[model samples]
Each structure stands twice: as C-alpha cells, then as structure tokens.
Target: MSEKIFSYLEVHAVDHCNNNCRWCNNHSPFCPEREYAAGEYIPWMEKLEKKGIEYDMISVMGGEPFLHKNLTGFVLELRRRFPRKSLAISTNGFWLGEEQIESYQMLWKLTDILFISLYPNLLRGLKDGGDVTPLLHKITKHNPHLKIDLRQKQTFRMIAYSEEPVEPNTFCGTSECTTLLADGRLARCGLGGYAGYSPNVGEAFRSSKHMFFDLNRKFSKGEFWNWRRRWPFDACYHCDSYKWRETNWKAEKGKRRRLDLELEHDRLAGGRLMALGNFTQAESLFRRTAEKYPLDAALCNDLAVCVSHREPLEALAYLAKALEIDPDHDDARANLRRLRHVLGRGTENARPEVCSADAGVR
Candidate 1:
C-alpha cells in the first residue's frame, strides 16, 4: 500500500439537496435522486488500503447528507474502515431542526468538522431574526462535543459551457482531490462527475476521456493515480468556478448581488492604466479586481479592454460576461464587435440584443 495521504476526498453521500440555492456549484437541485450504498464502499476502501491510497480527510457530503436515512450507519462504517482518517460533512443547516437534535449529536460526535452553510434567506426566517448567536447557543447547549463550521453565504461563481471551447488552467479549488458522486462514479471534481466535462488533456491522456471510475468495477493503483493527476482536466472547461472564468450568459441577473468598495480602487487604477495604453499593468490590475468583483460588468469590460491587444480570445470571453451581466452594456457589445471583427468572425449574424452599461472607462 502506498503511504501517500491525499489533502481531501469528497463523497457525495446524497444526490439531492434540501435547499434550492441558485448559486450551488454542484447544481444539486437538478441532480437525480441517488443514495450512496455503504456496502459498495467497503471493498473500495479495502482496495485503497491494499494499494496504500490514503487521505488525511474524507468529506461525506450531499445535496444534504442528513437527508439520507442510512447516513449514520454509513458514517460509522467509514470510521470502522478508516479509523485514522478525519471525517467531515457539509450541510445547509436547513434540516438540522430541534426534532433532529439527537441525530445531530450523533453526527457531530463522529465527525471532525460539521460544515454548516448559512444561507441568508434561510437565516432571515429563524425565530431570532437571522441572528446565529441564539442558534449556536442552543446547538452547543445540547451538544457541547460538536465542532461547528458556520459558512456565511456569499456570491458563488460558476461558469456556463461555451460554444467555443477555451483551454483553462486556473486553480478551481478541486485540484488534486477526488469527489465520489452518489452513483459511485469517482471524479476529480463534481463538474466532471455530473456533466461528463473535463479539460482537454489530449487523446493519449485516458483520464481526460474517462474522467472518473466506475466503483462497481475493479479498482486499481493505476486508476487511482490517473484520477489524481488529471488536474485542470479537459472537463474543466465547463466550470468557471474552476478558475472564476466568466460565462457567456448571465446566470444570476435577477438576483440581488454584492460588491465591495475596496475592489473599486483596483478597477479605477486599472482603468487609468488602460486609458494610458499600459495594457500589461492594466491587465494585472483588472485581473486582481476581477477576482474580487467577478460579477461586476464594468470591471469585466475594463479587463477585456486591458487584455484585448495581448489576448483577444480572453477579451472576447470577458466582454461576453460583461454583456451577460448587463445585457444593455453597450460598451461591452461594441468591444465584442470590434474584437470579433479583428478575429475575422463576422458580426452580420452575431448581433445580440441591446444592453445597458457605462463605457467601462474611468
């Protein structure tokens, strides 16, 4: 058995989630109903042990892990099988009510981290008016042994599939990790597991084409290593969160969005640099700003301008995102028009509806 310990291994214990969070990167609501069979994991674990495939942490996740009636049994089996590995679970905290306090106790007692995602909309409906202090107090009062991980809601980015594929190498947080889907398909990330999409690594790279393992089949050391090394795999092109890449269409237009004033400075500085024709400096500044203000159409447009001369394809993608965010963003539309023309892509049949946006200039 290899003694190498992986950083993380996420297992989707349940296919469907309790909450229909619009920004869910896992696209849980659309996922088909499926349950992870505990029995199926035993042989797999045995194989891993025999091959020395080890991990420091094992995340038992779901649309909601608690929704599974057999979760406790499965978790206990995992403890018995991988006694030295740390156990964890991620939840929305919607179903962790007073009625399930006992169950929560058993779960929290067994796991190293009880990651609770605090959705603001859900929090507002609480008896204490969205305040977590009382809830935390109640939970701790009942289960002092429980370790809580309260993750406050923020804008979560996701990329939509593009008609024209572009190779992406951005750090998508799933690098070097494995995700076991509910159907026993083990993938490097949820995108590949569900969408059959991954980065284009080349025809010779078998991992790019297969992307995951059929746990029902025989497991091997070669399969494990192949899955582990297929980072930034071809299927990655389907996910923007993999690298915070902008989508061609807006996925969150009607929803209320958040932005920070601190990022405005970077955009302004980047815009100033763009006006001076310092595209390299502007590109760096805008890139930093876009990381913080990804949904901001103005910032995306500015960044597009900065990169237009050096990387027109990237600029086209950015402009597309700008138009998607603010469909009325005329400047972005114009920039897209000009770039497409330079690229020799005809604008005659490429007309988009009028959009509203400032000229993306300082």
Candidate 2:
C-alpha cells in the first residue's frame, strides 16, 4: 500500500451566491463575480483521473452548487470520473424541491455523503423554502445506503483578510483538503478557494474537448504536501476562525504563549519606535498588534495618539479603526473626542502641523 494518503477535493463550480446571510465570512452575499465555466469541468476531472491522484472525497461548494446550470450533468461527471471515491457537496439547500429531489436520484446512487447546510432564519417556518428536511426525508426514503451529514449554519467572522472560524470540529485543517477552483487552481484548503489564495493546479483546462495529459502529470506527484506545510500560521492565528474551539486542549497554553509572544513583539517594537519618536514606524507596528490582539485597548489608545500627532485629520480614521478592533478602548474613545475638538479648532484657525520636528527634541 502506498503510504501516501491524499485529502478531499473541494471544487468551486460556481462563484455566484443567492442568499445574503449576515455572518458569512467570505462575503458570499456581496460576491459579484462568476468564474466557473461548465464546459471545462469534465476535462479537469479527466486530468485528475490520469494522475494516480485519487481523492478520498470530492466536495462541491460555491455560492451554492445547485445554482449551476448543469448541476445534474456535473454530479454525473463526478460520479463517472471518480467511480470508487465518495462524493460530497455543501449547499445552503435553497433550491431543493420535489423535482430537484427527483433530479438528485442520480446523485444519491453515486454519492456517499450529503452535507446540507441548514440556515435557520432562511428556512425557519417554510416547509419548502430551501429546507433540507424534505430533501433529507425524500433522499432517505429513496436511498437508505446514502449517509447524510446535516450541518447547522454557523457564523464565520472574518477576523483578518485570510482567516475565519467555522464551528468546532468543522475545520479539518489543510492536511485534509484539496480545493479545486474554476480557473484551474488547486488549493490546499477549501477556505483558500473562497479567499482566492489557493495554489495553481495546472494550466487552465479550457474545455472538455482537449485531453489534459500534461495537466495530469502536474497533479500526479504530491508536491503540495510541502507547500501546505509552509503556509503561514500567523495569518490564521489572527483570524476570528482561530477561536478557542480550534485550539488543541493539550497545546492550548503553548498556543496562547506563542500568540502572546507575537503580540508582545509587536507591542515592544511599536513602543520602542514611539519612544524614539518614529511615529510612522510605530503606527505600522501598533496597527498589526491591534489586529492580532483586539482586546488590548491600551495598544489601540497609544496607536491613536501616535497617529494623532502626525495627521490630526486622520486621527478620526485611526481612532475608528482602533475602536473597530477594540471597542472597549475607553482611552481611544476619549482621545478621539478630544482630537475632534482640536481638529475643529485647527480648521477654523490654521491647519496644525504634526509635531514630528519637535518630537525628537522632546
């Protein structure tokens, strides 16, 4: 047996979404771009097949995979391409109906797991308004062999640009994910696809007509293992998704220590620069520290003061950013109100220059 164990393949078949959920991390409701091409899907599958690289599970997700014009055809192709592999799809479960359930018969025959997203507010009382209950009942009635994985819709807050937290036990980390984008990029994780930060799988497979023999060669060798291992953990650490749930109980204190070290580094660096009267550098360091440690109101207040001395007009902007990061920053709030008064006075009289010149002397 080959010691090599490959992870699940996550394919983003469509970029468009219909529901505008409040807690969506990827900003799916606001997503305006559609990059998936129906014609290129089969060829991409074929390329993966040619590689000895067989996926343990193929996951189809998007704004909603059901929204794809050729969803039935796509599911069929996935079945045909990966005969032995299990198929899974994540959906908001909005478009499922009696006819849709009938269409799913083909998928039920081939699919092993059906991961349905239950949006409580969207499907609260309506019997047929995208509720997975009807579909689950129908699917169970038809195919007892299929395993159903019903997941509750959880809030994913974007703490940073790259990371967001899913519910506990939901995230399996990068080791268990192989994400496929419509543009022929293969990501190490499903989140990477939504974040537009995945690695390139191969040359763009344009259509199903062309045989992607070369593309197959690229995916066959598992070079992505090394790539995934090198992915920055700092980006994720600052993410709201890196919550207490994801922390390993054994390594909790250690992880907290590391995070504290990172925060301390930023704090010390910012403080040293501020003491030296280098407001610009200090401001940059403090901004990073604020993002990582949003609970630190002192950092926010201090950073606000540094920016206020240089750019009084930007004082409000920095203060606002600080409060957004740390709402309980009383010092920041008080300083912000005071600075606004100074700004008003400056506008009426003369624009106040930053004290960078006299800062060094002080």
Candidate 3:
C-alpha cells in the first residue's frame, strides 16, 4: 500500500462497547452514542486514498466491532480500497448470534487476524455456558484459514478514576497508537480524543499534534514521519499508564475530570450581553471573568473581543494574554492581527469591515 504512511491504523467501527470490562483500553464501555454508520468510513477512506496515507496493519476495533450491523460491508470496502493492507479485528466475543454466522464467516475471510479479548464479564452472557473453547472450535470449524489469537488476560495497564487530575505518566503504550475516530478526527490516541479533555489543561491532546482533519485538508507527510518517531504525544502525560513501570502503580481515588464552571458562567453572561447589544456590560463581565481565570484562553479571547472596538489597546493586551495561555488559539491570533490593522501598527492597511461604530464586535 505505497510503503505505508503509518505503522498501524486503529479504525473504530463503533465507539460504544457491549461488555463493561473494568478497564477497556479505549474506554469503549463508557463511550456515549458509540455507533457509527457503515457509510461513515467511506469518506475517510476516500480522503486517505486522496492523500496517499496508507497503513501496514489496520486494526478494526470498537466497544465491539460485531455490534455494527454492516461491519462486513465496511471490511469489504476496506479490502476494495486497500487490497494490500493487512486487516484485523479486536472483539470481546460475547455477542455472537446464530443469525449472523454467515456474516462472521465472511468477515473472517476478509480479515487476516482476529483477536478476542476474553473478559469474564462477557463470559457470563455467552450462549455456550460461558465456555470459550467450544466457541473457538466452532469459529475455526467455519474458517480454518483465519488466524485467531485468544487473549484470556489483559495486555495493557489500566487507568482508573481519580478525584483530581493525576500527574503525567511517561510510559504509555498509546505513544505508538494512532486512532482514526468515526467522526473523521485522526487523534494521536483514543484516550485523549474520547475522554474530552482540554488541550490547554495538559490532560488532553496537544493542540499542534492531534487535530480534526477534513476530507480535502492537506497533511504534512514530513510532520507525520517526525511525529511517528516521537515516543509520546504531549497528551500522554495526562494518562495513568504514561510511566506505569516507574510510578508506584496504585489505584487512586477520584476520576479524570475538567473543572470549568466559573468560566462557563462568565462566558455565558458575556454572550448574553453581546446578544443584547450591551458591549459595556459584556466587556466588564469578560474582564472580571478573565481576571478570575487568567489561565483560561477562551475567557481572555472573549475579553479581547469585548474591547476590540472601543478600547483597542486593552483588546490587544487581552489578546496577548490569551495567546500566552494558548499559543495555538486561532481566534485570538486572528483578532490580534485584525486589531493591529485597526491601530495601523504593522502596515498602513485599510480599516477592517467592523471598525465602524455599528459593526458587530462578537
């Protein structure tokens, strides 16, 4: 497949998992609205082909990939698109149905490897009295050519919930993991993407590394190779397994969470003021909110927005603060450039469309 753009590609056919393992690596059990349409993968495939991004080994995973009705169709499409790429599916093996045996056989034919993570929680619901041996025999009897790997025990370390944010760990397996999410976001790892942590807070993905790429978007091949050589994404520090070997591996109390209540309130109040055409009150609220959460880039950017027209210097200060907090904040950077033009600092550029008194500040 054109020498492979990536070493491995993890394609999640569905986000929500059927079995609730204590610590699913991707946290599939806790994922909400986990299902993906069979058609969702087509555009992504098209984009990959258009960009010439290929993978040597593609892992089709999910809460359980078998849960998706059109999984075989998706697999067929993968084969059709990239015939040389080796395909594999990681499943919990709990929900095999009598009606879908043929579909399973077809999937086995298309895929090169099948990894069944045999969790006890899934064993309870097995139709064959919780015995995986008979199921394995049955599956092999159907397609002897398929290579099956049965993992009775967990492979990776588990990250548990904690009351507060934990320190960044350095030894995570996800450093090598690249996940192509169902919604077309090519994330560095599943933990950073699915957990919904803020990039600025250091618990989530790096603003520069992990991003949502559209179908027509151009990716830097050199950057991709450079990132591949890097051991871990900056987001890995937020994970418990970052340096599992060195750290005292103890299950701590509490969960990974983000605290943003005060900031939300202030932003909402300011938004209402802006909507009501009360720029003065909006600016005051934004300023107070920015002071309360100086580290929050959104608040700083909002404050800059409020003061952009009436107080250009104050707006520049607030924008600068926002940039300091999040250097990758696009809106703040764009506004800074726009405000500079209004002040005629960099170039003798014409006044922006919104420089007039009646222009919308938001």
Q: Rate the local accuracy (lDDT) of all candidates.
A: 0.63, 0.53, 0.61
Q: For each candidate, C-alpha RMSD in Å?
A: 21.2, 20.2, 19.9
lDDT tens per residue, model 2, 49-145: 5544555777777766666655657777777766777787787665444433554555577667777766654455336554567667887776788
Q: Which stretches of candidate 3 lie over 4 Å from their true place?
A: 96-103, 127-130, 154-156, 160-171, 197-216, 244-362
| TM-score for each of the candidates | 0.59, 0.51, 0.57
Candidate 3: lDDT of 321? 69
Worst 10 residues of 2 by lDDT: 247-256
Model 1 whole-model lDDT (C-alpha atoms) = 0.63
Question: Candidate 2: RMSD over Cα atoms?
Answer: 20.2
Which candidate tops TM-score?
1
Order candidates by lDDT, high to low. 1, 3, 2
TM-score of decoy 2: 0.51
Clashing pairs in 2: 164-241, 165-241
